[model samples]
Target: MAYDLEEQEKLEALKAWWERYGTLATAVVVVVALAVAGWSGWRAYQGYRANQAMGYFEALEDAARGVNGPGGADAATRIKAASDTLRSEYAGTAYASRGVLVAAQALEEKKDYAGAQRELEWLVARKDQSTLQPVARLRLAGLLLDQKQYDQALAQLNNPPAAFAALFADRRGDILAAQGKRDDARAAWQSALAAMPANAALKQIIQLKLDALSGA
Candidate 1:
């Protein structure tokens, strides 16, 4: 009789403890389960997006490569189509930025300078890809220089990133020289020479340009 009574008391204690805490325990379990499920879903979505973006990038490259031959106009059209797909579906991906750059290069090769400018300008205005901005600006400045848009080219070189300082100064020299600002051009060339990497092969070319300026 004593053993039976003790067993009954233990069973009752367990029931009371469960009644007090069962709902809280159930809620914690549900929260943990949902968190784990959500994390897995997010990872899966990222993988899908990466794979899809890669496919679009591959198509873009194929189109860009095709622009070298006889049917180059058709290839350019295809490049535009692929670029549009990348921008529309994978704008957040690096592939989107790269596709636009590739399209710009193709347009430039085909002498469609206006089209190239539009593509490069779009990249410059996109705030999400901060790293590509300087490159786009540099290419755009070069285009402007080629078109004799000297002031516009200079404006793009203003306050460039440190790594591109030498290139920017070199381009500035070219623009100033074209405008007959000989003294400023010479100074800009000197700054470019000073900023350039010591071991760069282009240093020899820059030196030649500097010598020419001095002779002029």
Candidate 2:
């Protein structure tokens, strides 16, 4: 009789403890399960987005290369359409920037300077978190320079990243030289030469420019 009574008391205590903590324990389990499911769903969605972006990018490449036909007006139209889609829908993806750059190059090759400028300007305007921003700006500046839009080109070359400092200076020299600012051009080229790596192939070219400037 004593052992039976003691076992009953222990059982009652266990029941009381569970009644107090069971709800909290269940809630924790539910929260953990939801978090895991949410994470998995997010990963799947990202993969889907990436795949879609890749498809659009491939189409843009094909159009740019004239893979579908002789690559005339039809190809240009296709390239524009595909690039527009990528920029509008997948601007967050690396492929979007790449598509825009490719489209710009193709348009420039076709002597569609206005179209190329528009595409490059769009990319530069976004100022998104893309590493390609620098490239876009540089290309835009080059296009402006070719058009003899000196002030606009200089504006785009301002405050370039350190990695591109030498290139920017070199281009600036070209612009200044075109404007007949000989001393300024020489200084800019000297800066470019100083920033270049010792074994850089461009170093020799930059040195030649400097020497030519001195002779002039």
Candidate 3:
């Protein structure tokens, strides 16, 4: 009887514990299940989006290639449509950024500087697009320079990424030269030449600029 009483008391304690905590335990299980389902759904949606964005990108490329062709206007329209889709529906993807670059190049090649500048500025404003920011910065600076917006161009070229250091220096030199800051231009050119790969064709071009400044 004593042994039976001990077992009964243990069973009662377990029952009380379950009565107090069963509802909370079930709620935790439900929450975990929903979280897992949500994660899976999110992943699937992202994959679908990436695939759709790629399709738009491919179309953009073909259209971009034709933007300088005989039917340039028609091609430009197609590129605009595809790029618009990427920008609006798939803005978070690499394809979206690449599409913007392609569209900008096409617009610039047609001498549409305002349109190109707008596209490049759009790319630059996307803080999430770290991979494409430097490219957009360089292109935007070039556009500004062509427009004689010297101050704006110089500001964009400031503290360029390491990969673009030489090109940035070269652009700065151009801007400084245009402003008639010969000494500063020469310094910038020298910096560009120093940063350039040895025996690169661009180095020769930079050297000529430096030589010109020497005579000035």
Give each model's clash number. 0, 0, 0
Write down the TM-score of every candidate: 0.86, 0.89, 0.84
lDDT of 1 by residue, 1-216 (tens): 355878999989988989999899999999999999999999999899989988878887887887878988998888788888887788888988888899889888988888788878888888888888788888999899889999998898999789888988888888998899989998998899899878988778878987887898
**Model 2 Cα lDDT, one tens digit per residue, 1-216:** 355888999989988988999899899999999999999999999999999999989998888887335657888888889888988999898888999899999888877889899889988887774578888988999999899999999999899889999999999998898888999999999999899998899988888887888898
Lowest lDDT 10-mer window, candidate 3? Answer: 1-10
The list of candidate 1 runs beyond 4 A from truth reads: 1-21
List runs of model 3 lying over 4 Å from the truth. Answer: 1-13, 194-204
Between the candidate structures 2 and 3, which one is better when assessed by lDDT? 3
Give one digit per residue, the lDDT tens place, for model 3 in 1-216. Answer: 355888999989988998999899999999999999999999999999999999999998998898889989988888888988898889989999999999999988977788788889889989888889889998898889999999999998988889889999999999999999998999999999889889789998898888878886
In lDDT terms, which candidate is top?
3
Per-model lDDT: 0.87, 0.88, 0.90
Range of the 10 consecutive residues with the lowest summed lDDT in candidate 1: 1-10
Winning model by TM-score: 2
Sliding window of 10 residues with minimal summed lDDT for model 2: 63-72
